[model samples]
Target: MPTPNKPDFQPVLIVAGPTASGKSALALDMANTFDGVVINADSMQVYKELRVLSARPDDGELARAPHRLYGVLSGAEACSAGKWREMAMAEIAECHAKGKLPIITGGTGMYLNALTAGIAPIPDVPMRIRETVTAELAEMGHVAFFDKLKRDDPETAAKLDGNNTQRMIRAAEVFAHTGRGLASWHNEPVLTPPENMFFKKLCYMPPRDILYDRCNRRFDLMIAQGALDEVRDLIALNLPPTAPVMKAVGVRELSSYLSGTTDLETARDLSQRETRRYAKRQLTWFRHQMTDKEIIDTQYSESLADKLRHDINQFLLTTPK
Candidate 1:
C-alpha cells in the first residue's frame, strides 16, 4: 500500500545490506509502489566501467522507475564516503523538490554511516605527507604503524580495528600533517540535513550459508553476463594502480585469469571467496552500527515486501516533516 502523501512531508528511506542480499530488488519494488526514486549508495556502483561487475541496475530495472547516481563516475575518479554523502544529499533534495520519496540502497557501510550520522570534514593531507605516511607504514609494518597511531591518535585508534591498515594509515597521516587527531576533527560540526529530517533505515541480513550461496551464484551470473569483457575494456584504459575501481571485487581475480596468471576455475574460486568475506564484514558493520534499525533476514524471498510496505507507511505517517 502506498503511503498517503502529506503536503509538508518528504521521506528518506535507507535500505542497506551485504552484497547479493537482494537489497536492489526490494528497493525497486518500493520505488515502484511508493512513487519513490531509487538512489545509489554503493561506492563501487558509481564507476561507469564496472556496470556488470558492480551489478548495477539493468535497462529493464531502470525502466521500472527512476534511478540516480549509479554509473555517474569514471573509474579514474575515487569516490570517497564524504564525496558520496554530498552527492546523495543533493539527490535527496532534488527528490524532495519533485515530491518523490528518496530510497537509498546499497551494501557500503561507510556511505550509509555518512548519510545517517553525518560525515566529519577532515582536511586534505598534502600529497607529500600522504606519500610519506604510506611509505612509513609499509616500512614499519602494520603492527608498528598501528601502535604508533595508538600513541599519537589514541582516540581514533580506539575506534579503528588494528587490522584496518587503510584507515589506520589515514589517521596517522592526519596527525602527521596537522598535529591534530582525526577523532577531534570528527567532533566538529557535521554537514547533515536539517534537524527536522528523519530517515527510515532497514538492514537486510540473510542467513550466512544462504547468503554465501547467493554470492557464488551471482558471480557466476555476472561472468555469463560479460563481466570479463567489461574488465578487459576497463584494463585497456590502463588506469592507475591506485584507481578505486581496480580494487572492485571481481576485478583482481578476473584480471589474473585474463593475464594468464591463473585459470578460470581459480579466478572464480578466489572471487567467490573474497565476495563472501566482504559480505561477512558488511554483516558485522551493520550489526554493530545499525542496531536500532529493523533487521530482516530476507533469504532472497519476495514475501518481505508486504511487511516493508506496512513499515514504510507507518514511518511516513508518524515521522514529522
Candidate 2:
C-alpha cells in the first residue's frame, strides 16, 4: 500500500466513539494503510491491570501495528487528563518525526478535548496537599471527603458527579495547595495545539439500541474471558478504594460478585446496565462536544476505511490555510 502523504505541521487523526464501537479496529485498519501508529486515548486502557476489562488490544493486534501507551501504568498510579495529554503529545511528535500518521483512538472525551481544544494550566498540587487529601479521603470515605470538598470548593464540587470521588479529592487537593477553586482555573488562558497543526476528527455514533446490545453482549464475553480473574487480582492488591481503577465499569460489579455480595447473574446484569449508561453519556458528549465534526451513525461495514479516507480528504481540502 502506498503511504498517505503527511500533512504539514503535526498531523493527527482522532478516532473517537463510545465503547465497543469498533474504533480500535478502524484505527488499526487506517494505521496499516497509512503507516500510522496507534496511540491509546482510553483512560482505563492505560492501566496494566485492566487488560481484559479495559479491552486493550490483544497480542495479535499489538503485533500488527505500533501501539503506544496501552497498559503502561500500574493501577496505583492515577493518570489525569493532563498527564495523558503530555504523553500523547510526545508520541504524536515521535510519529511526526518518523513520517508516520498518529492515529489516536479511544472513547475518552476529556483526553480528546485536551488534545484538540486545549487545557487550562492548573497549578500543580503540593505533595503535602496530595498526601493530606489522600489520607483524609481514606479516613473520611467518599461522603465525608465530598462534604469537605463542597465546603472548600463548592463550585467545582457542584460541577462534578456525586460519585466521582477521584475528581472530588483532586478539587480538595487543589484548594488545599493553592487556596483556589478548580472552576476558577477554567477562566485562565489555555495551552492548545500549535496554529499549524491539522486535526482530522472521526466519530462513531451508532444507534442507541444497537450500541446498548453490543455493550451487554461484550460484558458477557468479558466475564467468559476471565475478567473476573482480572478483578480478583486487582482486589487482591488492596489498592486504595478511591483509586480510579476501582471505579472502572466492570470492577465494582464483578467485585461485588467476588465478595459474595451478589450472584454472578446479578453482577453481569448490573455491569451491563452500567456499560449502557456509560455509552449513553459518551453519545451525549460526542453530540454536544463535537458538534462540528462528522459522525458515523450507521452500522459499521468493511468499507469504513475507504469512507473514512474520503472524509479525511474532504476535511483537509476544506481546512483553512
Candidate 3:
C-alpha cells in the first residue's frame, strides 16, 4: 500500500547496508510508495565517470522517482564526507522546502554519520607541508610517520596506522588548522539532532555466508557489464596515479590487468576478494557503531518485509519531526 503523507512532519529515512544487499531496491520501493526523494550516500557512486563500476542505479530505476547526488563528482577530485555533507545538507534543505521525505541510502557509514552529526571541519594541508610529509613517509616508511605523529600527538598516534597516508595527512591537517591533534578536535562538543529533522536509521544485514555469496556474484556481474572497459576508458585520461578515483579497489586491480601484471581472471579474483573484505569491514562497522539502531536480519527473507514494514510504520505516525 502507498503511504499517506502528513503535512506536519517529514522524517528522514536512512537505509544502510553492505554493497549489493538490496539497499537501492528497498529505497526505490519506499520512494514509489511515499512522496520521497532518493538521495545517494555511497562514496564511490558519486563520481560521474564511475556509474557502471560503482553499481549506480540504472536509468529505469532512477525513473521511478527523483534521485539526487549520484554521478556528480568528477573522477579526479577527492570526494570525502566533508564535501558529501555539504551537498547532502543542501539537498535535505531543498527536500524539506518541497515537503518531500528524504531517503539517504548507502553502504558508506561515514557519509551517513556526517549527515546527522556534522563533520568536524576538515581543512586542506599546505602544499609544502603535504609534500614534505609524503616524501618523509616514502623514504622512512610508516615508522617515520608513526614517530612524527607520536611526537605530535601520542593519543592519535596510538590509534592510527602509520601506513594510512590519507588518515595521517588528515590528522596533520587537523593539527595545522586547530593547533591540536585530530583527537583533540573531535573532543569538541557536537550539537546534533539536526534542526526540524528526525531520522529512523536502519541497517540491513543478511547472514555472513549469504552476503559473501552476493558480493562475489555481484562483482562478477559488474565485470561482465563492462566494468573493465569503464576502467580502460577512465585510465585513458592518464590522470595522476594519486588522483582520487584510481585508488578505488577494482580500479587498481583493473589497472594491473591492463599493465599485464596480472591476468584478467586473477584481477577479477583479487577484486572480489577485496570487495569481500570491504563488506566484512562494513558489517563490523554496522554492528559496533550502530548497535542501538533497529537492524533487520534478512538472512532468510521470511521476515524481511514484515520487519521492514513494521519498522517503517512504527516511525510513520509516532516519530517526532
> Per-model C-alpha lDDT, please?
0.87, 0.86, 0.78
Better of 2 and 3 by lDDT: 2
In model 1, what are the clashing residue pairs, if there are any?
Answer: none
lDDT, candidate 1, 110-208, per-residue tens:
888888887788765654566678788889998999999999999999999999978987898789988999999989899766665678988889999
- TM-scores for every predicted model: 0.85, 0.86, 0.85
- Candidate number achieving the greatest lDDT relative to the actual structure: 1
Worst ten in a row by lDDT for model 1: 1-10
| Model 3, backbone clash pairs (residues 3+ apart or across chains), number | 0
Which residue segments of model 1 deviate by more than 4 Å? 1-8, 123-165, 172-184, 299-303
For candidate 1, give the lDDT of residue 154: 91
Supply candidate 2's per-residue lDDT for 215.
95
After superposing candidate 3, which stretches have Cα over 4 Å from the reference?
A: 1-10, 124-132, 139-166, 175-184, 299-303
| Model 3 weakest lDDT span, ten residues long | 1-10
- Give one digit per residue, the lDDT tens place, for model 2 in 95-121: 987978899999999999998999987
Q: In candidate 2, which residue ranges exceed 4 Å CA deviation? A: 1-8, 123-131, 134-168, 178-184, 313-320
C-alpha positional error of residue 51 in candidate 1 after TM-score superposition, expressed in Å:
0.5
Candidates' RMSD to native:
3.5, 3.5, 3.4
